[model samples]
Target: MTDDTVRELIARSNRLGADPRNTNYAGGNTSAEGTGIDPVTGESVELLWVKGSGGDLGTLTEAGLAVLRRDRLRALAEVYPGVDREDEMVAAFDYCLHGRGGAAPSIDTAMHGLVEAAHVDHLHPDSGIALATSADGEKLTEQCFGARVVWVPWRRPGFQLGLNIAAIRRENPEAIGCILGGHGITAWGDSSAECEANSLEIIRTATEFIEANGRPEPFGPAVDRYTALPAEQRRRRAAQLAPVIRGLASTDRRQVGHFDDSDPVLDFLAHAEHPRLATLGTSCPDHFLRTKIRPLVLDTAADAPLDEVVLRLRELHFAYREDYAAYYYRHATPDSPAMRGADPAIVLVPGIGMFSFGRDKQTARVAGEFYLNAIRVMRGAEAISRYTPIDEAEKFRIEYWPLEEAKLARMPEPKPLATRIALIAGAGSGIGRAIAARLAAEGACVVIADRDAEAAARVAGELGSTDVAVPVTVDVTDPATVRAAVDATVLAFGGIDLVVNNAGLSISKPLLDTTEDDWDRQHSVTARGSFLVSREVARAMIAQDFGGDIVYIVSKNAVFAGPSNLAHSAAKADQAHQVRLLATELGTYGIRVNGVNPDGVVRGSGLPAGGWRAQRAAVYGVEEQDLGAFYSQRTLLKRQVLPDHVADAVFVLTAGALSRTTGLHVPVDSGVAAAFLR
Candidate 1:
């Protein structure tokens, strides 16, 4: 019946972690006691494999587990320098490593190892924490599960806390687990399946108790005026405020943002006691870590004129940062991790929505999710009894814990374009797709914009989830759709920092054969499209006051005077000059404008094959497949240009390396001497 292996441990962890009903993301740790062969001694040594620092149990893998000799881990209890020096003990776990290259041990590692059972789970299930943090938590514990689960008082997580849980088990022989005061729940059993079952039982029983016996309207009745706005109104309002909020958040370090307006959130915000509860702040350490001490709750009404509301929100933002700094100064020890930031991570605006900020998109999104968990905990606690969380001092102790800081220090360095938001037009295919993929690889959150909705969605899906890329349908010729695309980008992320004007079409015709309609059609999609999208995105960037980049995918035909390409040549020429003009005009704002000219990119792009391949091939007296060869032969290097080649040039122009060189056109045409920008 007992399985002393990490495989079962990881399976149990993933099952508990994957369900939002069980625990928040990366908010719990699971462990198993097993015997493994020591590499040097060739002896079976008892080992404790636990979830590693800064990793999610749902995504747990063998490499993500910290393997330590159980005896060595337990030995630390003898020399434990008490609660005051518990942070020092985190360093001691490194010495207990059973093998090389396992993940770094987390602060909760000792708790898992010190427990008497072979399998243990430490989770932040909202239902369990609700009872754990209620005003009369110990009394409620007796009422709900009675002798099955014991109650342990609030103790900051470390060596001492681990000792406290172990002591509870000794005192309460009938208890399956204990609820840590103002924290989460811990469960244990002889096997992984038993441990998992016990943990779920606690969560399920608590949920049922809350539903059957708790009072109605735990948050009090909803305030009519504070209820959620209509769907369209909500999205529109969020889009308008996102830029202003993003600008404020980017003050110390540029942050990407996520907005949530789910029913649970709206229900909480509409309640009478929302402000009081939020002001008390999040109780769980994991909650405050992501949400900060509390949110910046906006008092402005949803129906108020937006411009005036923005001003009020800005004032609140300034006050929030000031109050945050005061909170830091109140409890910060000299060694406390130098005030991670003073800006509010969670912003609450009643009737509108919640806006969460972080160093990147996924982080921002996760922060919002954690706050939702906090909301759930609060609701349950209020239903059963008076809701209470850990005091602010305790929150500060865990927030600035040295062990947590060290874990942060071990994270991989960010990619070059981290925090930059990009909107790439024509991203559905060809050079645009290449540019989108390249930018995403460098850590940019991209917005895929194209006339073809399905194509744009396909490309966006390939890039990644909404955190990495979002698709927006846009007809470059239509001013309305162009502006909407910019708004969609702001709504999806916070704002725009990079714009690629790659949406274009080509039509090749001799002077006598070319029609007026052909000339107008090509120019409308290419020249006008670029101008409209750039104007809207530039407005957003200017409002953010953050310098940005705009790159146009021009063609070598603009300079080379290629045959049978009159309309295409004229449009590209117009686009090439516009880049220079915009660069000079927008230079004061530090918005860099540049162009990348490529010679007949006939391989991957739909543009080449869309309609002009055969015409251009006939013009050069070559077959459709041989057209690329003909274009390459004319170049000095006789090298065919690829979509990725043009993509590289676009990246070089915008990726900060060429910051000082604006209005400069970079050529990706395999050494086209005549096509060089003069």
Candidate 2:
């Protein structure tokens, strides 16, 4: 019977979470209560089931719902002193758990306890918040909900909030729910089904009323349609601006992932009054925790030069940080913990879409998605009147609330490469793809750059992370394209941390037979391409004021002579020497340059199949089938070198295995004496 109730609660929770108009990610919570055996005491007790803190209602399960002893939970209200209850309430909630679930109950658990209902659902529905967060939202709530709803002014969520709800419920015995001013709505009933129905009805009625009362008009500055670029161009512009915004948001020097705003985001940015409106706080307190009370507004035109955009971003960032610092210090008490640095979580760029920053991909995506939802809510509210968020004092209280900060403090430790970003040249196939996959596995965001855009997309798809792996088309031989790719990577992920120059080609011809075209092509990719990619990426790394790594994929032919591989060998040798020169120059910037030399790997090396390997083998008087055997036997280790082996060598260099050992080469040929350094 308890299991059945938990299942129904989870189902209803997911139903509410499914729509953004209902709630943002993990922002809503639902609960059901029943008699159950306490896992700790082994006694039948009255239990209050509530959503655990940080659990997403959209995917809530039994484990995510914490069961507490009802009497113990309510008893906390009696023992608690009135001062600084926010932190005390959190401890009280933990103490009241009825079982060994161990998960902390939602901060709103006390309100659920005070309501005399079998089930309760609390949500930040757009219709409710649209009315609740407006200038005259309290008055509007009474007008829309009538006698069925009781309105409660905003207060920090804690035992104190529960007392307020309890007092309101006593006065309005027949009320279906309560509207939390500048916050959300709380609905209650004898069953989960009834509660869901009541919540939806209130939302529907409120939405209809808003639609009838509000008039839609263009609110933003008039955009010059003639100068406005296409949607694709706008998106590219957004990507390019992402890195600058991300750099400004990095208070701890750790790079953040960037999430581009949606199509609806463009509609919001297109408004004339957006400069003022976009910074006027979010729809509810929940949003403030993720997006901050207000976004940092940065404007750029659709056709703005890349350099100009970057400059404006830096200037705006300085201004935003200054303002945020002033705001933080003004509200901070001496007893308060050190204020977090003033890095904007959400950035509003007028001509392009908005961008959200987070320590990882998921958090960044959540902020971006929530801002898009806020845009919808604002549009609805603004259709009737201007958006008026909660007062700055209240916002400060919520933003600096001890309980909310505790949640972040409780987060799991980060991965080794958690805040790093990696860009790989020619990452669509073979060794490049393997290297990309490995880096991503270690928690770095991997940008796949390849001449084959489709293939890059395919490889990125296989990586299966939201913002971690992105595909960009890049032609290594073109200086303009190479520079643009580097910029695009910085825009997507703050700045480049490591770049693998794995894009190369071979010309199987003797010096006498090789044509000018063949020589130019080989040198174009090998010598010139490496130079361009390295130079452009190095600039980004230098600008970030942090050290990075560049790993070049050279060939054994750089050391050993091949029968007819003149052009390819010469180019390889050229880059191998270039690595030493680059390291000497880049070391002052903390940048490390290394080379991985691999020989005769059949699989995943972009080596031509069948007749190509046969022909190469015949150059050494070996049969096609015996080629692998011959190479393995010639090496002292007697092992066939695989693509993954070369990738591992690159990983070691990039992962700091050779932090002080730059300008060096690691041969992945199973110990070839001829290729060994003197």
Candidate 3:
């Protein structure tokens, strides 16, 4: 191709973002100038232009391009000491470009100078990087490009990497491109179009490899591993992470994803104690910029020193920072800014993949998405062969570079949910208690109201000085009690933020055996109580100028009417419709309303006097023991429901976790309701 054609290709490449996923900012570099043997002289021309470190590829200009003498760079590398290698390399290039007037040469100048081709393009493209860092990376590479590509294991970038590539090219002169294991790739061609085409081909081939092998295994069989872990162990682990996460977040309140100890995958991850297993790092180099190089391994058996773990993690962070400082001093010129202090971009707990933290939500979200994608690619690479990671020093240099650190710092501030408040009724026990606990865990100050004063106090005691939870007693069916509850909650917590209208009643009786008095009693608590409490809470919330979330704990009977539950079914059906009206009327005020319809919560606190055993015996007119076999055989899962199951549904609704859901009833009956609907 002609020089004009190559220049056009360079401009097009510069216009493209580093990561298509990261359109807001660019993360790569490029150059158009070429270097070769000058026809007039026996020596090579100082015609190479490399992109300066920190310049965005997406909007690169002539000023961003760094012109350098390829011959001078090679000479300096050969004579410099190992520790002074980067320094001498930079100095030599600076001297060569003295009066040329362009940006400083990129840190990768030494490596790029060694390439024998006329045009070379390098990128940390997500697709190719994902494959390169995966387990069977070499095999995956061969499958993609056949004999056109060469795979080189990870080595420190700059001198060692350049030397390795040179040796590989010498050994395989026919190779069109090179894949750096656990890093990125280099595509060289006779023309810029050919080189860019080769790069695109490599990415497409790697993407296909991932498409064929990267999906997570079906969760059915894997769930057993997560489910096997003890609940207490899971709780403790979550609790320990909570305070640390809160501190990292710099917020007193934050909601965390569910901690499912019963998940087979989680259980397996928790028990993975083998030393060999513990050494696994992230799948890609960019992941290190989020989750750090190593994970925080927890030894649950012995008295694991949490303080020691934190101290060690901090030490590792500082060490990473110091190494980054050394790397900058070695590679950067005096004009370059000082390296940022090394705080981990991501943290990995032994069992957890990685945790990305930022000052705000958007930063955390971007980091998290990148980290997860890297994990998937890493796992896919592992499927092909044992995947390794980039060297610690190299990653430290990239992660702590002043330019990258500035990118993270420049991220926009997070949106605030600070004015929101949540109130959980019937929170002294069962699902109410669980919802209250979850909302409080997420940083919401919760006022827990229950008929039983002692139960409210007990729950309040458990939560302690976090003051995120306050307890009060109220009779939901009484207007005075409902108003007083709202007044007290608003007074203490500032305003009514969210109202979990979960206080209700249930009674099971054959249709013909049902009494008018029994029906009235059930309606009083279920329908009337909901209306009373909701009306008062809504008025208070509207006056406070802050809209709210209201969730009613209805029943599956509202949809598939249950046998021998005429009164309870009728009451719940009415409550479900009431929630919809509230949603319609409150939408303008920014209030949300939803419902959870649970079938039979076996171990729930509100279960009738005889429990499931008695209820089944009564239904079939048989002894309790005989009813067990009948119930177990009839149900799909054969396991009774736990209070926590229903509580989880309420928590998700009241915590404002589901953004699009409102005036909708979510069934928490584990397919029972599905079967009935079908």
Candidate 4:
């Protein structure tokens, strides 16, 4: 394919995947094929460009699209033993790579290649899946769109499905698309635009049929009444259940669950037929790998006390695991591996919204997205008639398939702090950004909250992994914004495990020169902001019944006096005292509170940028070039401090290096006698 053609194909894939109604995150694939010069052969040949297995279509790039020799990929189907050839097929695809660049093509590459079209789009649109996965899916499909689309029965995706699609095309040469029973839809055309239009046309046909001929009338009151409840009430219920769910979902392997909940979740969970709909298994067979067959449904009401709620949830988790074990034993084949413990990927609670579980924040969020899309599709199916999807036997087959497991096995091992979520205030720059980066590197997913939205986004983008960081704009001093940030953290990462109170400001003026506004502004951020974040996060951690860490970034001025720094010094002193008091009070709940006090950092610290160090240097009558030496001479170590030095102390305390210690101040200064802790 020409460079322009490749770019257009990738752009079309991104556009199709961008709509959640059309495709869930990482749930679909696309391909484009044409004649191109082979890198190795140096001759013209047919090349098939397909989306890689793990890449997200919405963010598809030229590099993410794997290029393969079309003849080589198709030739593997001829000699391969038809049964369980997934591994061999994958090897053949990898073997045909044009060059050393690009990842392995998606497992569905064979199916795309057999279509004989210039461009092909395979998407799991909710509307199409809703109609196709139903009990009478084939009948309904024919009734809705006559002969324009063909219906293919459930077949495991591999060489067999590719052959099946080819046979269908041979019989129905005029059909524009094929809807895979209990899976998704596939469309092909001479160009990317034509393929896009054909897929949309099929979805529109199904949607119209469901609305006109299948829309349910006078929905029942039991679930309908709950869905009608106030939105705030639903959100509050979800928040209350979030920490308990996280605690119950945690495993002995030290995996912590992340949660996503909202009004849509509440409505789905509270629906009259929710119990039946939620347990009927996934709307599509491919989802069996991510969501399993069914979700765990809890019946606890929102009015229950925290202690009682925790006890009940523990009982439910135990029962769910036992049942899962029984199911595994009943269906185990001789080839089955050692049985893994039952961990629910999705949790549905009455009154509260549904919560999804994963080994890390991004995984949980992705699972949540899939389930939410499932709910939307299932709702459409139910509106038409009872939503009957694939049976349990087929679900188990896909769940244990080695081909699907290989995708997960290819991933590298996680970091020591993997799956742990941390919230860092003022992380847009300076010491705060350093701390955030260090934590993310250690495997903890960091929430970059800052007053500057653009800076936070830039820092988040700079991080190497999409799963490691999320940026949120937050003014720590505002109570509403502070509370929203706390909720965002819980929703994004299940519950808070670490909090870095790093946001601070200063007014470098003497007592008489400092105005009332200066004092309030300094205290608002340094003292009051710390209190709010500490209190809110502590409440969430305590609810989770899991121990947490909170570290305050205090200044050396909080311990020793500095003239012309009255407002900042007083505010820092207040928070330093507050940390000790909070440590004493929250220790009973297993929450550790500590502080890190740094003297001076000549570069890349908030002190220099905000002119606090310059003002002190001016008081000493020292030039800018001599500031580092002036501060270094005051310490015994005779070396200037850096932001990274402060960040190291923070990690030591927060990352369990000081698990049994709390309420003490760690000094990051080279060594200042006047600022030394007593």
What lDDT does the true structure give each of the candidates?
0.89, 0.80, 0.61, 0.80
Q: CA shift at 241, candidate 1, in angstroms?
A: 1.2
| Error in Å for residue 289 of model 1 | 0.9
**After best superposition, candidate 4 residue 238: deviation in angstroms?**
2.8
lDDT agreement of model 3 with the native:
0.61
The prediction achieving the highest lDDT against the true structure is 1
Colliding pairs, model 4: 223-272
Q: Could you estimate the TM-score for every candidate?
A: 0.96, 0.90, 0.44, 0.86
Considering lDDT, where higher is better, how would the candidates rank from best to worst? Answer: 1, 2, 4, 3
Candidate 3 C-alpha lDDT tens digits along 101-190: 367665566566677765666666666676677566787788777888889887645565666676776678788777888777777776
CA shift of 52, model 3, Å? 1.7
Task: Give per-residue lDDT, candidate 1, residue 465.
Answer: 90
Better of 1 and 3 by lDDT: 1
> How do the residues 1-678 of candidate 2 rate in per-residue lDDT, one tens digit apiece?
787888888899988888777888989788888888866578888888889889888888778888888888878877878856456777778788876844578778988887778888889888787777777877888888788988898776777887788788778978888888778888888898999998888788888988888876636546663133576677666655565566567755564656564567766777676776776778587787888777887676757778887788788888888887888888888765577768788887766767787778777778888777677678767776668778877788778877777887998888767777888999998889888888888788889999999989999999986577989899999998898788778767766789999898877776788899999999999899999999988877776656789999997889988688888899999989989999999999999999999987765656556655766776778887778788889899998888788878877888765779899988999888888776
lDDT tens per residue, model 4, 247-307: 7777434444555446667667665777777768785765656676788887656555657
| Evaluation by lDDT, superior candidate among 2 and 4 | 2
Better of 3 and 4 by lDDT: 4
Which is better, 1 or 2, measured by TM-score? Answer: 1
